[model samples]
Target chain A: MQKTASITIRRKFRVGNLVFHVLVIAFALFMIYPLLWMLTSSFKPGTEIFKSASFLPETWTLESYTYGWEGISGYSFGVFLGNSLFVVALVMVGNVFTCSLTAFAFAKIRFPLSSFWFAIMLGTLMLPFHARLIPQYIIYNDLGWVNTYIPLVLPKFFATEGFFVFMMTQYMRGLPREMDEASRIDGCGFFMHYWRIILPLTVPSIITTCIFSFIWTWNDFFSQMIYLSKIETYTVALALRQYVDAMGNSYWGALFAMSIVSLMPLLFIFIGFQRFLMDGVTMGSIKG
Target chain B: MNGKRREACAGYLFMTPWLLGLFGFTLIPMLISLYYSFTDFDLLTPETWIGISNYVKMFADKKFVGSLGVTFKFVFIGVPLQLAFALLLAVLFKKERRGIRLYRAAYYLPSLFGSSIAVAILWRRIFNKTGLVNQVLALLGIQGQNWIASPGTALNTLIVLQVWQFGASMVIFLASLKQIPTDYYEAATLDGAGKLRQFFSITLPLLTPMVFFNIVMQFINAFQSFTPAYIVSSGTGGPLNSTMFYSLYLYIKGFGEFQMGYASAMAWVLLLIIAAFTGLIFGTSKNWVHYD
Candidate 1:
């Protein structure tokens, strides 16, 4: 009797576990369904999108991708993609060099008013961008940098993006200050110590900053839209929007195709560095 | 010749970029916005000085009031609901079950692409008149309204979209949960505490810091929510202005209408509102937030 009851309990447990696994799998599918739909719709013929309910394209073609790249917008996406790449690359370099330098000082250097300045920096994090948008626009206009990428890329050189600064500072704080002291004892000046010793040791934090700045600059629409008015200067995001705005009825397939193409690079970068992204975000939030 | 003097100069030099940007981009603009609030400046021409008239106009403006109301509704309802969903999912995924990594990844994917224009466009498609949601309703023998086009349901649809990306907060909460001592729960179980009881007694208390963090973050983020509304409503605050969020209205005033001075005033007002709301949260946090 005991043996029979034990067998029944074990069977029930197995059934329960199976049910749990099935539910998890279904939830995963639901989360991924939109991306899948976007991918499939991108390949489908324009008419097939509205006609078919299947997740897979009945007749796949590269027409949409090619058309999306060159046809819909008078300006080819190559220009926009290049512009975006230039801006992102500049911002990445600026963020790594400047944000890390500032973060190093805040973390290792002992100075009067250091804590006070740190508090002030954290306080600035609460300042909403909208509050400063009008003023920024006027300044950029006065500088005649409105149509250029200067306004977008220049801010990073100043360590104005507070989130990156704060993340780098926290990571630096976790490291031993003995490294700085030892470097100093070795007759290295602050700049040399920063350049040779601190920079190399903080590769993880530097990568974190680079990844964030790249993704942010890549996906940034509002500032880019506000700054770059001419079609020649437009990023892929602005170009994509124009396509939708112009050909409202027949271009949904092309728009989806371009979106898939635009998002792939960012998606790849994110997944490739998922660990750093997760750690960076977790560290930033925990300290707050 | 003094070390102190050299160090001070070095510190200033290190902070030069930030100071320049802060003064040029942040501080000067902030001050300029304050000045512009009292003027009627268009970008094409010089400023025309006006007094409290802009503030008065804002108070009397029906659209402004409507947008504020819409924003308020979003903040009050959306923030709590999003945080709750995030916490629930965090707890569910916190256990050491098999295949939990897949669940974690699935839950986090939405937030990974949360603010992307592509996701926003997808949201519009999902809630369209004859979209996937309506198709599902049809399967249930129920008729679905034109969710994005109808005035009654448009803003609510955006709210639902905002709530859907609760993954960021969930990940943070999961991290915080891991920090809680397992011994506390083990000791509680020794006293014959049930799972639910132990959760309230131990988990909730330990998780308060993260709860406060998520609340403040969500509130701030929701207040600045512009992309989803812009994309979903097709940039018109739509169908009957049901989806005109505060930030969207500000954008319309500044960029669409070219009322730079008035928009600056509106921007300052928004900053004040956000500051006041966050201040209130911090003030009340003393009572409930527990730290180890």
Candidate 2:
């Protein structure tokens, strides 16, 4: 009797496990179906896209990609892609330099009102950007910085993004103070300590910052829309948005194809650096 | 003593860029915004200080009031639902299952591009009159509304888009869930506690802090959400203004119409609205949000 009961229990457990996997799989598919549909739809002929909801295309073609690459007016899709890359690259470099340098100060060196300044920095993380948006626009407009990458990439150089600063500070503080002291005892000053010792050790945080800065800057549209008006200077975001006006209902295939092309780089970075992204999420939560 | 002075000097020097940023970008701009809020001006006009007029004008503005209500509904409805989905999936994934890593990765993919223009474009097409949704409905012999064009469903579609990207919150929840001791579940099991009982009595209480964190962060983010709305609504927030989110309206008012001062006033109110809600959540969190 006992042996039979144990067998029954094992069978029940197996069924339960199967059910769990099925449910999880169904939900996961539901979550990702829209994206897959978009992808498959991009390859579909524009006319067939609205004919059926099936995510799979009956006949796939690369014609959309070729046509989409033709771009709007005189600007090719390559120009938009290049513009995005240039802006993203500069923004990432600026964030890495400004955020790390400022965080190092908050973490290592002593100064008057150091704690006060650090608290203020953390406070800025909670403050909404809208509070300063209008005035910042005015300032940028006054300086003739509107319609330039200066308004976008320049802020990163000043550590205007407080989250990165806070993240780096948390990371640097967690590092053993003895490392800094050891470097100092070896006749290294603040710059050398930060450059040769602290910076190398803060690689993980730097990577996290780079990933975030790249994604945010690449995906950014608000400032890009407000500042960039010229067709030549339009980023992928601006160009894609303009495509809606320029393409209207026609060329759905091209629109979808170009959209897919635009997302590829971000998706590539995400797949490659997913571990760092996950770590960054958790770290931010812990600090949150 | 000399070394201390030098260190302090070095620290200040390193902070120069950020200090300039704070004053030049954040702090001083905020002050200027506050001053701007009291005046009236368009792009071409010099600021004419009309005491409290800009603030008063918000009450008379139809779009301002409508957008406020839309935003509130979006935040209160979208955020909680997003958190629910996040928590549910997170709880399910808490156990060590086969292929768990791949599953989680798949689930997390949408949010990576959730706010991007590509998704926005996809979303716009997916809700069109002859779009994928309606086509699918037709296959089942059911009529589907033009989701983005109809006022009632337009906001809901936007809400769905927001809630669809719950992966970030889910990842956070899963992280916290992993940190919970297995012994609690074991102990509950010995007492004949069922899965549902254990979830409520043990898992939930332990998960509140992370829940609170996600809530605050997500709400703050949802309040500032502009990209998806701008893209999905085609920058008009139309279909009877159902998708007129506050930030979009602000952009239209300030930049689109050149009502910079009016936009400044609107921005301050948004700040207050955010601050008040955050404060309310924090104040009430002690009752429900438990932490170790």
Candidate 3:
């Protein structure tokens, strides 16, 4: 009788575990189904996309890609992608280099009002970007930088984002001070220690900053929309908006196709560097 | 040079970029916005002293009030639901196992593209009358409306989209959960506490910090939410202005109508409101948030 009772309990436990796993898998599918639907719909014929409940395309074609690449007016979708990449690249470089340098200053160097300056920097994290939109627009307009990528890229070079600086500073403080002492005894100057010992040690943080910078810049819409008016200067976000506005239901196949294409690089980057991305986000959010 | 002198020089040199940005981009622009808020300056017209008229006028504007109401509803309802979903998922996925990473990635994917134009556009199609959501509803023998086009469901649809991207918060919650020592659970179990009881007594208390952080962050994001509403409504915030998010309304006022002063005033109000909410969170945190 005891043996039978034990067997029944074991069976029940196994069933419970199986149920949990099944539920988890179902929810995961729910989370990812829209993306799958979009991917399949991109290849489906225009009319069939709405009519079919199936994920598989009844008819597959490359017409959307061809039409989307041709783009609206004189500009091509290639131009949009190119513009996005260019801005993102420059922004990433700016963030990694400038944010680290600022962090290094706050972390390693002891100077007058350093704490005050650091406090100011952290405080800016709470300041909403929209609060400064009009003045920024005016300033950029005055400098003739409004239509160009400068408005998007220039601020990054200035380490306007304090989160990266804070992350790097925390990382630098955790490093062994013995290395700095050893470097100093070897006749290393401040810049020399930073270049040889510090910069290399902080590669993880820099890469983290780069990943975020790339993604944020790539996905940014408001600043790009406000600054870049010309179609040729439009980033993928703005270009996609144009398609939705102009075509509505007319070229949805093409719209879906381009949307998928726009998300491809981000998907690749995220999938490739998820470890760094996850680590960066988790570390960055930890009360810093 | 003396060590202090050398340190100061190096620090100043390294901080040059940020210092310049502080002055030019942040400080100066903030002062300018403050000045602009007091004056009636359109982008095209000359500035005229308004003397708090813009701030005063906001009280009478129905659209402004409606926008604030919509925003409040969104932040209160959407943020809590999103945070709850994130916490629940974090708890469910707390155990280590094979293939969890793939599941994590699949879940985190939406957040990575959460605010992207493409995602917003995809959301539009998914909620349309003949879209996937309605099709699924049809399979269940239920009728579905064109969710985005209707006044009643438009805002709720946007809120659902916000909640759907709860992955970022879930990850944070997972990290916080990991920080919690296992002894608490073991001790609770020794005291004859069940799984649900331990979760309430141990897990929830320990995860309060993360819960607080996610609430504040999600609240701020929901207030500033513009893209989904914009794309869903085709930038009109239409269907009788039900989907007119505060920021969208502000954008229309500033850029569309060229009411720069009015927009600046609105921006300042938003900043103050956000600051107040943040302050409230921090102030009340001592009561409920447990720290080790």
lDDT of 2 by residue, A1-288 (tens): 979988998898998988888988998888888788888988998788887777788999988899899998878999999999999999999889998999999989989998998889977877878899888888788889888889888888999888889888888888997898798889998999999999999998888889888888888899899889989999999998988888878788898899999999988987898897654343543544
Q: What does candidate 1's lDDT look like per residue over B219-272, in tens digits?
A: 987888888888888788987888899989999999999898889888888889
**Which is superior by DockQ, 2 or 3?**
2
- The residue pairs found clashing in candidate 2 are none
Q: Pick the DockQ winner.
A: 2
Interface RMSD of the candidates, in order: 1.8, 1.5, 1.4
In the predicted model 1, the residue pairs found to clash are: none
Ranking by TM-score: 3, 2, 1
Candidate 2: tens digits of C-alpha lDDT, residues B92-150:
88777788878888888888899999898888888888887888788899898889889
The parts of candidate 2 lying over 4 Å away from their true place are A1-11, A279-285
TM-score of each: 0.94, 0.96, 0.96
Task: Score candidate 1 by TM-score against the native.
Answer: 0.94
For the predicted complex of model 2, DockQ is: 0.70
Instruction: Supply candidate 2's per-residue lDDT for A99.
Output: 87
Please give the distance, in angstroms, between residue A215's alpha carbon in candidate 2 and its true position after superposition.
1.0
